[model samples]
Target: MNAPIIIGAGVAGLAAALAAAPRPVRLLTAGTLDAGAASLWAQGGIAAAIGADDSIDLHIADTLAAGDGLCDAAAVSRIITGGPLVIDSLRAHGVRFDAGLGLEAAHARRRISHVKDATGHAVTTALAAAVRAAPHVTIIEHARAVALDVAENRVRGLWAETAGGLVHLPAAAVLIATGGVGALWRHTSTPPGADGTGLALAARAGAVLRDLEFVQFHPTGLDSGATPMPLISEAVRGEGAILTDETGHRFTDELAPRDEVARAIVRHLAEGHRVRLDATHLGAGFAARFPTIDAACRAAGIDPARQPIPVRPVAHYHMGGIAVDARGRASVDGLYAAGEAACTGLHGANRLASNSLLEAFVTGTDAGTALAGEPDAAATTAPAAPPRRI
Candidate 1:
């Protein structure tokens, strides 16, 4: 039998491949091996429960609260407790983290881990490098899985449309880590490739899906006219930024849950009031801290230090996808999912800010480990391509 296939190359996909180590797997990527993933665009730091004043239970409580009681309690506890270990795993893969754990809105303590404003870039680049160096992984780029070939409800293989052409690869198991559906929206922070491919693939394979409508719009996406709006990470507000209107008067609580804050912005905008994020008080420290955001603002011809950055709501995260269990196993056998593509009942109705990266890491690692423990690929049928068209 051929190796199991892992689709997507974000942090979750990379983490899954690394955890499946010593057991080879085939990985498919839709773009550049290192940069094209939406993970590279994530601005906020990851959340972990390792801060001096924090505890796993507190983290769980905050996640549950943000999720608005829709989260699975056990899942919340399990994943949140594993965050520190995820941090350790990233470091083990040569992902260097910058100074300071951050505090995101809705969290009672400073439990977010970071490599400054570009956490995603640092973590993704490092993990991709580690995977490239690993002997157990084979990466095929610019390839998108179009369909899963399932027989009798078990996934036998998948057909992908690549730069070369259509090809099929048989495997004993397949894991979907294809990220989110944010790009499906008119204004979003997800890459164009994040058009719900994993959810589609999983659903096509007869995998159960849930909560397909729980999209969380971020409150402070830079109100630029870019196609996919540049995100103003929650960390900015968690630090000291404030939300103000045209009159420069504070309106809603800046650190409220993402949905609430976004709703406030949307309502304010609907009423014809312009909203802005006042990071001006942060001064030059803003540039040194959020270089990516600062640069984007500057490119928009506005200095964050001198102006209250123009802001609005933009779809940032999906709190739904293929339904899966604790080990990231989907309802179907021989199939698994992690990251934004899989709804493991953690995020619930609204995702706690910065919890996405943490979920991606924990679930990916869990899924990979489970895959490694499964029956060896050699015990399965050989690769079989779909029938050719006339």
Candidate 2:
């Protein structure tokens, strides 16, 4: 029998495959299951209102504020409440978080659950491992999806370019969890593969898309003459790190919403002011708290503990994608989008820091759960790209 197909084996795709459960699943990734995903580079933790002093309402308000009050209140409340449950589900899958929650900019409380500074690495790695061991799931690595085979306004399957050649894969449903469009920009902090491939597929298939105008720029990317700069996570700023100009004058609020900070840096740079992030106040303990970031800094020959790291604004995340409902279903039937590929409207104008991971897991689960109750996938003569014979 044809199985439901999930594209891009990032956190969202892994979670969807796991949640689809005893139902057989076919997971397709452009690279290996463990590589090329932008999710692996996530340094900050996932946001969830599980802190003792935190409440769902406060989390919702904080998210809205970070989003510049452009959020959908209903969707914001719904998705934020799924945080604790997402944590619980991940733990059930053998993923262990750090002892305490982390605090980031725009949060009223410390509600970001993490595993050190490598939260994305830790979380996505665990989920991918669990997916590997799942009995009913089939992982197809290095198979880049080229197009969706939509006929009569419904998705039949997709055409992907595999190692041998282009082939048509039939599925009951298609969930696009491919990451954001950050890499499309010249100075993105995202991996090279995160170039809006899935978003393009959705557009080609005529899926409803929104928030395409809301790309976010991170202010603290290490400007180390790198192609895709390494991110100096917001958690560093939350921990008393400050942004400075050439003469060591602080230019912007270290903990403001990302857009404000990114704009400040850009404007300052346009005025010929050099920017740097001084984490000297954090001292040597910075390495203990953020080993991954410390390593990245060291690789660039900068000791963040003692020196001010060169910084600039770079494309970070996209707040818009294929618009989806609460169930992560997109405009087309038998086609769903999750993670950074789907615009659930939880993120209105901008995404609150670290909320990306939570959205990935929650939306993936929702789409998979919704699919569990659906009928089996139907077989059809799907279309292939590059004039390949099917």
Candidate 3:
């Protein structure tokens, strides 16, 4: 019998692969498992209700506020309640987060767990390592899914572009954790390969897509002329970095929700002002706290500790994609999605900072568990419909 096939090798896919353990999984990646995934580029860390003052209700409230009234209440409740479990699971897989939590923009409490601003790298590395060591998981690098093959309204297999040219991979189940579509925009903080391929494939397979218009433009993308712009994490602002216009005037609250901050930057730029993120006050601690941002700024001929870093709003996270249920099951049978590629309505119109990684971990694990049950289970035939948009 064919094993389950998972597309994309980011955190979501890796988590799914592990959770679907003992049920052989073929994990496909467009590049080396860890190299091109947006998860590796994430710097803000994962948000969880793990702090002493934090609670699942608080996390849910914050996420709903950041989502701008479009989040599904039940979905938000489910995911937020599962946040600590996700963090514990990651820790169990050898991912080390900081001993203490830190605050991010718009959060009422300090609840972000990180590894010196390289949280994504830490989590992805650990998950990938676990997946690689799993006897039932097969990592297929450089295999990009081009389309899904559906028969009788259910996915039967998929067509992929491999080194050996196009190949058909049949599967009893297919999971799409292909990340986001940030690459569609010229100015983006996503890797070049994040072109929403999974969304496209799922749509072609008759899966319902959701909230495609609600792209989340990050407020602190480094304007260094890189194709996929480098991100200056929101944690920098939480740690006292400030955004300024050409005249060094602070125009908006640096800790505002991303949509508000990004709009402020865009408005400034449109009014003939250059927006800059000034971390000069951070001094030497800047390098230690955010080595990634510091190195990126230095590479672009700027220094975060010495001067303000030029920044602009760039397409960062997609607040929408192939809509899925709490279990990451898409509307179509045999199709599941997680991560940025799947919209479970946890992030409605805007996403709260650092929640992306948490959602990926939770939904990925849930999807895997669901798929691991009953190989001959009957599939749902609901038409592609997301929860009612707010």
Candidate 4:
């Protein structure tokens, strides 16, 4: 067997590479670190069972309920149980989660790991830096994987296009962590580059793509024409930010789960009523706590100190992808997936407030440990001939 090919250098891809440590692993990305990924843009933190009041069972239930009807109970249970361990591993890798705040968001207890509000950026950046330093890992940026090649019912390799031309790299195992399918929508908070490429590739290889219709719409994408629309953290509501219609009438409680809040905001828009994030209560202190939101509101010419930040739900995440077992292995042998691109039933219908990163950590290591038991091998060079363009 050759080194496993891990696609997408987002948090999940980085985790997969790290998990496949000591084994020659090639981690590939469609763009630069944090460039085409929603992982970096995540304003909230990772969900965990680190709090005394919050048990793993509770977190698992919330995830399944949010996942709507498509969640796998066993898979969700596995991720919740392993959540804290994954966070600890990332912390060991130098990812700084927000601490000493008592409690951050969503969790009934203080279980969230944050690095200020830019928690996703903190985690992804830390993982990418660590991956760069790992001698066993190889990162190939500016390479777009167009498809997965499967022969004998197993993933064989990937077809990628680079500045030089198309390159086909065969692997002993393939891990698809290419993030979500947010770009499929007309308006989205996702990076334009993460347009279901991994899902497409896996499906092309005869992998099952479930829950394609269940897209999670975030309640607060800054309603400006900013490239890669800025996300107003859900923590805002947890911190007393209220949602109101155009006439200053409160429509829905901000503390509700994301799906409810997003649906309410969408309803208001449909009824010709605009909604906004009211942060005036915090006064000047609000800007200091959520600098990212403050800056985004300021750039859009809205004053969080004085007025509400305009917002609308945009496709922010997908609760679906290449289906995987609790160990993050895909349907195909020697193939695994983690993070947003791999659906391990952690997110049944809708993802919990900050479980995406947690799942990446847990599943990433699970896939890694599973692969580590296998024998190592020489690096397999890509095929000399390229497939015809699509």
- lDDT for each of the candidates? 0.87, 0.88, 0.88, 0.78
Residues 115-145 of candidate 2 have per-residue lDDT tens digits of 8899898888999999999998999999989
Itemize residue pairs with steric clashes in candidate 3: none
Best by TM-score: 2
Clashes of each: 0, 1, 0, 7
Q: What is the lDDT of residue 307 in candidate 3?
A: 92
TM-score of each: 0.96, 0.97, 0.95, 0.93
- For model 1, the superposed segments whose C-alpha errors exceed 4 Å read 376-390
lDDT of 4 by residue, 200-294 (tens): 77776777777776788889988887756788888777678888877899998776778888888898899999888898998897787788889
CA lDDT, candidate 4, residue 247: 88
Using TM-score as the yardstick, the better of models 1 and 4 is 1
Residue 58 CA displacement from its true place in model 3, Å: 0.9
How far in Å is the alpha carbon of 63 misplaced in model 2? 0.7
Which residue pairs clash in candidate 2? 172-377
TM-score of 4: 0.93
Of models 2 and 3, which has the larger TM-score? 2
